[model samples]
Target: MKYWLGLDCGGTFIKAGLYDLQGNELGIARRNLAIIAPQPGWAERDMPALWQTAAAVIREVLELFGIKATAVQGVGISAQGKGLFLLDRQGQPLGNAMLSSDQRALALVQAWQKAGIPQALYEQTRQTLWTGHPVSLLRWVKQHQPERYRQIGSVLMAHDYLRYCLTGELACEETNISESNLYQMARGRYEPALAQLLGIGEIVAALPPIVGSAEVAGRVNSSAAAATGLLAGTPVVGGLFDVVSTALCAGLQDETRLNAVMGTWSVTSGISQTIETGFDHPFVYGRHAEAGQYIVHEASPTSAANLEWFCQQWGMHDYRQLNQWVAALPKAGSQLLFAPFLYGSNAGLGLCASFYGMQAFHQREHLVQAIFEGVVFCHMTHLKRMLQRFPHTRALRVTGGPAKSAPWMQMLADVSGLPLELPQVEETGCLGAAMAAMVGTGAFPDFTAAQQALAPRLESVQPDAQAQAAYQHKYQRYQALIGALQTLQSGHSKEAL
Candidate 1:
């Protein structure tokens, strides 16, 4: 039987899997990858080491299944969005990849915003001035590492870098390219004007050719085949940013559908044909892998990361135990508040995880519950913004690590007052990549056909009306607290400016 491969390159791991065209998952392999913290507010990955690990995992999966390299039809990639992986003339990684958590780019993004660059940027890309975006990181590189920047031949994200390593061609997929802040969303292409504004136009030759997320990127190289155990002539498709692929895999393809992907960070996205954005409240919109469609996304910089942080602080080991302990607590266990800004603000500023309203009687359980509540509350804020702007969403599809927890899924459903549908496949990013491959390889007539065939069975979770009512009251308090926090922030900004 023929098989298709889907690979997911995440911040912490590289996961690969083999599947049939009918969506029966054969096997999945995951290998841990390291994130190097060279300095505070900066995260990176050793690009060469990561590539080797990816190949190792792919080879292992194929061997385990007793399948030859020639049996694989096509390959698709899905990776964490943002970050920069610079390549040299010989297609070698120049240095460690600058991760999405890196803040060295913040100052440059701020300067662009001040110079009216972000305004033009928003008009083109629907993005705000945020750190970890490629535009900000690229500008930082040009200003701070001119010598190293001079050697750069092309810029690729995590998956794009992997694609280049496997295929000799260098190309950027649309979903990730649009997040670069240098790509024009409406026009669906890179902006030369923005590159000139940043004074990096001379090196524009290094930028990857932008292509559809499901388009054929290239054939595998002999070196890649030796390392990954894939056929040399096997086709590799341009993959997508994790978010877009997750949405597609979870069946959030229509304009009226939305998805909540819970991982280290929580991302909320929807499929929209039109761009819905504004000054104070706006979202990044970009073209979908499926032609004529666009994706509208809002992200909470930290969700599971905050949970992980709290677990460490409390010395908890198992998350299942942690969940049970928190669930046993009374609803709204403590009066404490947590803003969950461990990764800084993706929305607005001053969202740091707070322990406000804490009393002398509170314990770790209450604090943990408070943090969980705060994360869910923050998600609800995004949901409100999304629904208000679009107002046509049918249901919210929830996917990823946290979605596996019944308590967490139900709590989110209750807090958001929407039904949460969990995909049959927990790893939608990988499955989405497989779907893209199938479409690109002509196993299916079109993206819609591929989606229909691979769209997993969705497990439904509905809000408990009583629990929903309780969360509604807490949500009001949450809004009031956010307002108060914003006032404090304004006062502080006034002093600083």
Candidate 2:
């Protein structure tokens, strides 16, 4: 029997899944990845360590299922987007990989906003500037670590680096590179003009050739085959950014349906045939995993991670128990609002996760509920912004950690006043990666055919009218609170100066 291997490289874990051509899961394995925060607002991962973990997990899944190395037909990767992974001329890492959540380049982003660099780049790339983007991180390195920047020979995203380790090929996948701020959205390639505007044109030569997500990048080299128990010369496809992979796996084929990722990021996005630009707020227009499509999104680090943090701090190790506690709580009357910005904010870099109206009478349950409400509110904030462009959005395909919680899904439905559907596959990113492999290996004609054969079984949830009304009132309060906070923050900044 033929099989494919899908590897999803995430912020805190590397997951590997073995799947057949029909998308039936044969086996899966995962390894925890450690992020090093040597200083405040920094997230770094050991470059070699990441590749090792990925290789180990792939070997584990293959061994567990007792699958022959020759039986695996193809491989694909889905990884966190926007993180900068640099390699020197000899194909050695220059330093640690900077993650998507790293905020060390906050000052650079702020300076660019002050200097109008963001507006200039936005006109060219249609992507909002962020601290973790390759442009921002590259500029940071150029300024702060000139020696390392000068020696850089290639610029790669997280997945690109992993693919390089496996296939020894230097190429950038389109979906991830589209989010790098270096790519010209309209022209579909790295824009030297944009890089010049960002003052990093000197490194444009460092950018690798772009390849479509499903295109065969290279074959598994002998070393990689030995390390991962895969046959040498097995094809490795150009993979995708985790966002696009997950969205595709959730069956986001058209523009009418939105996909909400409630994991480390509260990401709300939809596929679009046309690129929409010049929004009042920041929204990303990235190339979708599927060719000839765009994935427009409003994303922020405001989702299940908040709940994870709370549980970890409080020693609530069991997720089932935590869900039971949250499920038993009364609905919609907590007067408290959570900002859900533990990682960062869409509002601005200065704003953080907060509770607006905590009272002495409120207990831990109220706080827990506030976290839940806060996360949904954050999703609503992005969804409302998206609705301005995609008013035809009929329903949402919800995925990630929160989809495992029934009460959380219900709250999301009530808060957003939209129907939500959960995909049967728990690891959408891995499944999407496998789809890429299938297409690359000729198991299917294209992504569309592969998707049709592996269509997910879904469970639907609809809005509750009374709960929606309550949330509507609370949403107004949430908006007012945000405005007040922004004003107060602006005032403090002025006062400090």
Candidate 3:
């Protein structure tokens, strides 16, 4: 049986999987990734360490399945988006990779907003300015670490760097690079004008050549082959952003479908035939892994991580126990509202997580329920925005850590008033990457064929009309709470000034 390898490099873990052409996972391995926070707002990972972890997992998975290196047909990667991975002229990492959650460039983002740089760039890229974007991080390096910035020769995303490490090639994948503010949504390439506006024009030379997700980037070189136990000259396909990969794995084929990811980030996305930049709020517009479609998305760090935080702080390790407690609580009319901004806020970078309307009568169950509801509300915020463009969206395919919970999936369906579909596969990101590899290696004619052959069976969760009504009222309160918080934050900023 011909198999493909898929590597998923996420913020907290590097996962590798071996899959057959029929989408059956033969084996899987994962390694915990460590993040370095040298400063309060900085989040980074040792570049070499990341590659080592990825390589180790790849080797481990192959050994687990007892598959010879030559038996694997191809390899592909799916990784977290918007992180900065810089390489020198000789393809050496300039420094630790800046993660998507890093806020070291927050001040630079604020300065850009104050100077109207974001507004001007949005007109071209249709992407919101964020501290973690390559352009922002590049500019931050230029100003703060001038010498290091000067040494940079290539700027790649997380998966791009991994692919480079494997294939001895340097190229940015489309879905990932399109999320960088450097890529122009309308023009379909890196925009020099946008770089100049962000004051990082000089570093534009560092941008790698762009490749489609299913295209062959390069073959595994001998060094990479020796390290990972993969055949030398095995085709390594251009990979995908985790968002697009997971969406594809969940069977999102066209504009009619939406995908909600409740992982480290609360992400809602749908494919669009044309770019829609008219939204008053920030939404990411990027090229889909499949050509001729745009992945319209809105995301913020407000999801299952909120529950993880609550569980950790309260020393609650058993999720089943937490779910039982949450399920026992009243479904409606809870006075507590948790703004799931523990990492960062959708409203702005300055706002932090908080619980509003907390009363003395609130119990642990109430807080837990509030956390669940807050996460659903956060997904609603993005799904609602995406629905504006995809008015015909009939169903949402949800994938992430939260999808494992039936109660949480029901909450999402109830809150969004849309049927939720969960893929039977656990590692949808890895499966998606494998699909790309299959396509790149000519195992399938195209993505449609691979998807048709490998798409996982899905279980559907329908919204409860009665519960939707209750969430409708509570969602209004959630909006009001957000507005009130924003107003309070604005006032505090003025006071500080």
Top model by TM-score, which number? Answer: 2
Per-residue alpha-carbon lDDT of candidate 3 for residues 251-348, written as tens digits (9 for 90 to 100): 88887889899888999888777876565776678898877887888888788888887887989888887778776765766978988988787877
Of the candidates numbered 1 and 3, which has the greater lDDT value? Answer: 3
Q: Estimate each model's TM-score.
A: 0.94, 0.97, 0.96
Residue 483 Cα positional deviation in candidate 2, in Å, after optimal superposition:
2.4
**Evaluated with lDDT, which candidate comes out highest?**
2
Per-prediction backbone clash count: 4, 0, 0
Error of 2 at 176 (Å): 0.7
**By summed lDDT, which 10 consecutive residues of candidate 3 come out lowest?**
275-284
**lDDT for 367 (candidate 3):** 90
Off by over 4 Å in 3: 277-279, 359-361
2 or 3, greater by lDDT: 2
Q: Give me the runs in candidate 1 sitting further than 4 Å from their true place.
A: 276-280, 313-315, 480-497
lDDT of 2 by residue, 426-462 (tens): 6887888989999988898888788889989999999
Candidate 1 per-residue lDDT, tens place, 364-391, comes to 7777787778888877767777787668
